[model samples]
Target: MIANFSQYGIKKLFLPITSVVLLVFGSCKDKAQEKPTEAMVEEVGTADGFESIFDGSTLNNWDGDPTYWRVENGSLIGEITPETLLDANTFIIWQGGEPSDFELKLEFRISENGNSGINYRSELLDTIPFALRGYQADIDGKHRYTGQNYEERKRTTLAYRGEKAEISTQENASEPESLRNNVQRNAWQSRKVLESLGHMDSLKTKINNDWNEAHLVVKGNTMQHFINGILMSEVIDNDSVNRNASGKLGMQVHVGPPMKVEYRNISLKQ
Candidate 1:
């Protein structure tokens, strides 16, 4: 009887100790789950499906004005000099075949007065050398025109910085006098600002003459542009006649004062 009583007492003591241990570990687990610091990781360029396009030493698959475009310091550099100033913009095109639905990413730096851009889903003008007409992810040193969508030699400004626009076809679409760059072109397309991404001046504060990451997410009829990991502008085009789903890609150096633009780490995912 004494042995059985002692056994019962030992079990009673162990039951409370087991309960306390379980409660301690359970409380620690709950506290650990409350702070998910590991899950809040920021990701950049770590996504799948990306492939490097620029070889860093050669312009083998790119075509443009030899005098203006060159490989310098492991970057694709396009510069304009007093002797090479132009009456129109010029482009250094990518010959890597056009992308239909894809994401493009790269880093760029521009001179204080430089004006340049990334042109995609574009068609090279047969009548003009180094001229492409299509969608442009606009970039400029002034930051006033940076991060906008400008259709080169075409429908002009489709979406300004801090804007999200939906473009559709219309029977009669006219360019309002309030619109700038109504450059000798007309399109049966209408653009509606769906929402504001942010304030333009506030967004430009994130950009500078330093190296900035430029990302383009062009899928289906939607095209989004991001600078320094911030969304700058977006356009959803339903204008079938005016939109190009797939075409060539290129970089531009606009006509104006002598300026320089450098690009590196050009990558694409399709």
Candidate 2:
């Protein structure tokens, strides 16, 4: 009788131990089968109203010259290879709606000599294919022009890095196209620098060739550019005549030597 009872007790313990082992193995197997996801992608459905514009793996709703744009390793890349040099600036424009009052955020990394910019409140240039004329959040490899508010092919430089300025309408307004692309097109606009956000060199320390976050907050006549949470530049676009209230959004691969720029985590809050 004693031996029989001992055997029953051992059996009962073994069953529970075996069941626990099976459950452990099954849990691990299930987890291993699950695919990995990027943290940014996972946050797409979060409570925040910000929604991702880029799907990380595809450019389904984007328009650009395929020759210079592509997706690799979950990034939107634009490369101007030595063999595929460009004569004029090109862009990968977002096919989504032209957000008028919105906040834009993204992560970007550029090659040492790379020159790129984010165009907002912009319109497609009829004169040049893949070109834009509107407000730009300027970016470059050296951080020289990074965080600046430039009106590409339009009013020119609205505010430099570390500047808070107001762009007002000019009576005799018309900044004609010049031989140089960066030439000031303030013909019918006047910029009054309100104050210095900070020193250029001091603010530049917040940027690098590595991935960095850029934030653009444009509501009504006010536009703000932030690099890594620092207010780099701000512009009050009072130039109602030339200001673009709403238009397309695009990323630029400026005309220059061979260079590369990668963008990811593109989210917009309208």
Candidate 3:
């Protein structure tokens, strides 16, 4: 009787153990046989009431020189080699739509010689493909020109960094003025100079060589530039001769040395 009871106990334990093993193996086998799920494509979404301009995977609504522009790692990349040096500055014009009273934001990184800008309320030049002629939030790898309000192919240098000036076309009105770079506050020490004026520094320190946030707010004739949450420059464009009310948006790759610039997370609200 004891032997019978022992045999029954062994059978009971073995059956349960075998059942568990079979169940686990069956589950694993079923999972393996199931088709692998396809990866979901990322859906680009708007941010802070701003609509996305670049899908990050394709240049669906951007127009530029294909040799220098591409989408890589989710950034709009513009690169040029010494052999592909351009004779004039070019742009990747945004085709999604033009903006008037709007705010534009994006992230950018440029090589040491890279010169680029965010052009808004700009018109395309018939002389050059993808050329813009209007307001540009100027940027340079040297941090000398970054965060300045420039008018491309128009009244150049509307306002410089660390400056709060009003520009008007009226002969009696105050013309474009700037706090010219000084020895102690030269391009290398731009941040210090701006800090002295309680403005966002244009020093390379505020910009990560890898990536930095650039924000442009344009409402009517007043435009503002900010970098990494710091106000770098502002322009009250009362220049009746050159100020634009509305036009296309673009990204520029200035003609000079061989350089590269990457931009992503571009969004605009109108």
Q: Against the hidden reference, what TM-scores do the models get? A: 0.78, 0.80, 0.72
Lowest-scoring 10 consecutive residues by lDDT in candidate 2? 179-188
lDDT of 1 at 263: 99
The lDDT of each candidate is 0.87, 0.87, 0.78
**How much does each candidate deviate from the true structure in C-alpha RMSD?**
7.9, 8.5, 10.1
The number of the candidate with the highest TM-score is 2
Full-model lDDT, candidate 1: 0.87
Per-residue C-alpha lDDT of model 3 across residues 1-270, encoded as one tens digit per residue: 234547568655556777768867997989887854443222233235788889999999889999889999999999989888998888999887788899988999999999999998998999987789888899999887888877787556766776655764534222333222211222211211122324445344676777999999999888889989887787776656546899999999989989999999998888
Per-residue lDDT of model 1, residues 1-270, tens digit only: 234547568654556777768867997999998864644542333457798899999999999999899998899999999999988899999998998999999999999999999999999898889999899999998888889998887778888899999988643333444233333343213788999999999999999779999999999999999999999999999876668999999999999999999999999999
Give the alpha carbon lDDT tens digit for every residue of 74-177 in model 2: 99999999899988999999998999999999999999899999999999988888998889999999889999998887677889999999887765455454
Candidates 1 and 3 compared by TM-score, better number = 1
**Candidate 3 Cα outliers beyond 4 Å, as residue runs:** 1-47, 171-204
Query: Which ranges in model 1 have alpha carbons more than 4 Å from their true place?
Result: 1-47, 172-189
lDDT score, residue 21, model 3? 82
Note the residue pairs that clash in candidate 2: 173-188, 174-188
